[model samples]
Target: MTSLLPRTRTMFPGLTEWFDAAWPFGERNLVRIEEVAAEGEYVVRAELPGFDPEKDVHVAAENGMLTISAERQARKEEKGRSEFRYGSFSRTVALPRGAETAKIAATYHDGILEVKVPVAQTEATGQIEIPVKKD
Candidate 1:
């Protein structure tokens, strides 16, 4: 089964983004993401604009976990007000119990990164075995 809980980290409960966007010097954490479980696949979408996916984005899977990381350099000589985020950012999520990490796929388009993880389907045998031992 897949976990429906979000694993994103933040300084404050719900104000980290606001504070970061306002101050632009706060300790940054995971990027915003949406996870969905389809009939035969688990999908995750992360919002990452103003970055070159081929050069700045990376995805990896290991030990039943999936991690997405990206880095962006700050623009120089900006006089006007700006609320853009810079530097490195990363987030990791646990893969579902039956997730097929070997066949994972990812794509970037329109400032969004989409990751697809194939899931293996297992049929229920409707039986359980219990072993007992003398103390």
Candidate 2:
């Protein structure tokens, strides 16, 4: 079958060699993460497409820091195949002020690991009415 996309090697003459230099198949074990704050919780999500949360992923929080890591080893039969790299990845995120470390929780679903941390409620003392001058 004819492929609409140009052959990879043709585009970058040395790319194939560069890819195989590290892994048999040019692969990079890069973990992407996103942290967001909403309402009363801070949410952190990491992408671990092929990892099994039970064995390959870990989440830890200490000293106002949250760390997420994932490790995956390629099978013997899968070596030299074009695929995600077989290696370990880790990312550390700084906890925002007032983050409740004790109330943190994590859940993994659909290749994403999400960790939620509660924020201490801020005291809203009272609202002050602005005095406007009438012309």
Candidate 3:
């Protein structure tokens, strides 16, 4: 007699339904974000899996905010067998103080997207002093 323990979904319909409802079998989507501060720049690393560099990435900066968006094409094989499909994500972060927007750069490699922004330099102005006379 064969043990029907692992493949006993039919025996526990309620448990199978609960598990499926809690976490769909096919919809796998996740995004990991990391922020690093260096001496002269602030670096942000985003993990984007199964994404095309040409048509699925967008990076922009406006109003002191930097935005990164990425999308992945849906696989045809996952049409009916699984609930998971193509995923897309967008994240925006505020530019750090003294960060130079003009010198920002981004590169994607090995499923990791890295953005480097140069820190801005604030010039110190000379202080003015007023002389006080005793009345």
- RMSD values for the candidates in order, in angstroms, are 9.3, 7.5, 8.4
| Sort by lDDT, top down from the best | 1, 2, 3
Model 1, range 1-135, lDDT digits (tens) per residue?
122333366434345445444245554455889999988899999999877999999999999999999998888875785556688999899998899998999999998999999999977677788888989
Candidate 1 stretches greater than 4 Å from native = 1-30, 129-135
On lDDT, the candidate that comes out on top is 1
- Clash totals, every prediction: 0, 0, 2
Colliding residue pairs in candidate 1: none
Residue 128 of candidate 2: its Cα lDDT?
A: 86
List candidate 2 segments past 4 Å from native. 1-7, 10-29, 78-80, 123-135
Best by TM-score: 1
Please say which candidate is ahead in lDDT: 2 or 3.
Answer: 2
